[model samples]
Target: MKELRYLNKYFKKYWFKLLIGIIITIIARVFSLVLPPYVNKSIRAVEGYVASGSGDLSAVKGELLEYILIILGAALLSGFFTFLMRQTIINVSRYIEYDLKNEIYDHYQRLNLGFYKQNRTGDLMNRISEDVNQVRLYCGPAIMYSIQTLTLFFCLVPIMFIKAPTLALYTLLPLPILSVLIYRISRVIHKRSTIVQQFLSTLSTFTQESFSGISVIKAYGLEPKTNANLQTLAIEGKDKSMDLARVNAWFSPLMILLIGISNIFVIYIGGKQYIDGQIESMGIIAEFIIYVNMLTWPVAVVGWLTSIVQRAEASQKRINEFLHVQPEIKNEIDKDTPIAGRIEFKNVTFTYPDTNITALRNISFTVKEGETVAFIGRIGSGKSTILDLVARLYDINSGELLIDGMPIKKLNLKNLRGAIGAVPQDAFLFSDTISNNIRFGKENASMEEIVTMAKKAVVHENITGFTKGYDTVLGERGITLSGGQKQRVSIARALLKDPQIYLFDDCLSAVDTETEEEILNNLKQASKNKTTLIVSHRVSSAKNADKIIVLEDGQILQEGTHDQLVGREGYYKELYQHQLSEN
Candidate 1:
């Protein structure tokens, strides 16, 4: 019910369409109800005339033909209204589905990276697809039919009571039993449907993860293991789906049984009343039977409609939970002056959400405009976190981070991020043409500009070797490209930005030393008069930096020029000596 309240906005937004649909549905039901009463009158006329021994056969024939025309007209009108009802209401549902999906996707885009890390991609996809369809079922057909059922009951009930009160009362004797069955079956259906949806999400997540890491599984020859795990998930999903189906299966039979019981009562009571002369012509009995039959479809469909409502409630709650999440990072309006490529961290500290341990602790450093600073650290030394903070992927928990002498939190997020170009360690690339991937850094970048940046990153030759050159579409995550090619493409993408500052998180890790040196030299030449930060584990990569900062255990252990650090007896010196010994 609470989740339904959240949907009021959509209903209100399209109230006119819903109202038109409802009106048409009511009109359709009214047309259906008119036939039974007219049918009673025509039968009574024929019966009375026959009982009187009148030879007015022509009159009876004329009346019968007129009755046929009326019934035909009613049926045609009913069908048209039904079509209109479906067109209006179902179209509203489609529109609402479009709106809801777009809203969710937009919110997903605004949410911080932490939210993505905490949730599975498959679970989110399921909510957007399967859960939305469930909700649409409730919004359209379920609601439409429910209203139709109630309308048929109200309009037809009094007509039945007028035709034969006692028989009508007897016909309703099965209602309480029917109510109990509906309640029980609906509860089970709702519960089982929820379990089925959850298991489906689990199956989706497992399949997605397996496909994404297929290469790793194949490399380790763990195909059998992966298949077994997938089989287990499939079985779990199938079992839950079967449980839901079983609950729903009982509904149709239960509805038929209830309707059958009511019909038995009508036959017995109406026949006895007429035999005892307590009732009038047989037409009344015929009318009563027609009214009871009218109740059949609605009563039979109650279980299905209830199942739809229950499933919708379940899905709405899940969707509501996702929509209500508050983003961890909030962007502010622009007020700070233009960026000067100078970055400073003053006593900054950060701990991830839901964790007690700090990832960065009281770390402070400054890089002046046009300076190239490199952070060299072992794994888990927080080198990447520093770069992440500079990009505002995650906000610092304490102290201040500034660019161009203004606190970063005060700077406009879009402008701040636009000023810094980053090539992450993963070197992620979307499924697009190689040229398009490079142009992502600058949306309006020309082909010539893209080629220039590609040459600077030393990936131009690779592009020329491909059959489609810049037009070749990449596979997921650029799996079609080698590791070195991916890294260079990422670097080229970043280089195309030509930002005030550049952040490279081991972007050249996959390339050979000579190639790395060549690319770095080109980067140095291209990035003149701009700030640069490189997070690297390789001493060879950091050896030519204007300044080197060595981090250990989330704290700065050393800061000096490359030559100065090599002369010191600390972690930096030890790392340099170890690399020298290895060489």
Candidate 2:
């Protein structure tokens, strides 16, 4: 019932079509029921003709022909209505599936970054693809067949009782018992099917992770380990599938037993009625046999429909859960005003969800308009966390982040993000032409502007040297480019944005010292008036900053000009000496 309510929105949209389909299905079943009676009537007509020795052959032939025509007409009507019902249901199912998939995708886009951080990519994929498909399958055939089964059962059961009440009662004796057994089996199947789906989701997650990290695995020489892990997941998935199949295996035989038992009872009762002269004609007995056979489908369909309902219910729960997850960060405050580039972190503290220790404790900082600030820190020192907070990727646990004296939470997210440009470590690129990748930051950037930004990043000459130049197609994640080249492209993209605040989070680390120096020189010129923040482990990278802050253990240990920090002879001086020694 919960699953039904979850899917009610889709049902409402397609209810009219479903109603039409149901009508057609009922019509088809009615016509199908009419055929058996016509068959029996035709047989009786033939027998009557044989009983009269001095036969009026033409009258008997006419009667027989009339019954044959009725049977043929009923069959034609059944086929036509059945076809219409199937087409309508199929069309509705496809439309609903398409809408559901797109809604899920749109919801995913609206979710905050923290959601992606916690959820597996493959699991989400399975929900949108496999789980949605399961729902679609249920919506179409399972729904249509269920309606057909009910229609047939209700329409035929009364006719059977009217034709031979004793026999009908005897045949129906096993029905309640069959219902109980099917209900129990359905519960078991539902439980097992849910487990099977979960295992498949886990398998999907593992496979996706392995593929995405294939390069890392090879670099670390862990291919054998990855393969073994994948094999283990595959075996688990197989075992779950086999377990579900085992349940299904028992299900069919039980259905056959129920059907067989019903048929045996009918045969016994009908035979006794014929012997006692309570019923007439072998033809009528044959017609009852046909009606009993027709009932078999409705009985068997109960099990099948139950199975589909269970699977769809399981899928619905997963999809609903995904849809219900509130993003960690959301724009709850109203925003009707514009903002300037000035930013401040006032007594802000943050602890990642599901953790006891705080990542950022009592942190406060400010960046004035058109100022350059550098953050020097070792790994895991909360430098990235500060940058993420400024971007509103994660919200602060306490205090406020303000842009241009206004709380950032009150500003429109799109407007806030539009004013910031970020270049992180391990730059990402799509499998597209170099030109398009650079144009990503500013969608409407002219070709000339793109080339100009590339030149500023010191990558124009390298790109133009290639045979295809700016039109050269890069591989996934720009695997075709060298590390330095990838970083330069990333920088060019950021530069194209022409944002007020530029964030360079170890963006220059991949390049050699000489290339880094050239790019930084160009960046210094390009960012002459814009506020910029550089996060670097190398002291040389922060040497030219107007203000440098040294971070350790999520705290600012020191802040001063480059010369002042080195003169202090603290952690900054030791880092500087180490880099100088390495050089």
User: Which one wins on TM-score?
Assistant: 1
| TM-score, prediction 1 | 0.92
Alpha-carbon runs more than 4 Å astray in model 1: 52-54, 334-340, 566-570, 573-583
Question: Model 2 TM-score?
Answer: 0.90
Instruction: Give the alpha carbon lDDT tens digit for every residue of 154-177 in model 1.
Output: 888777777677898898889888
Off by over 4 Å in 2: 1-4, 54-66, 110-114, 334-337, 431-436, 444-451, 460-480, 525-529, 563-568, 573-583
Q: Relative to the true structure, how large is the alpha-carbon lDDT of every model? A: 0.88, 0.86
Score every model by TM-score. Answer: 0.92, 0.90
Model 1, poorest ten-residue lDDT window? 329-338
Clashes of 2: 0
Q: Could you give candidate 2's per-residue lDDT for residues 323-392 as a string of tens digits?
A: 9887666766665556567878888888877444577778788888888889998887888878888888
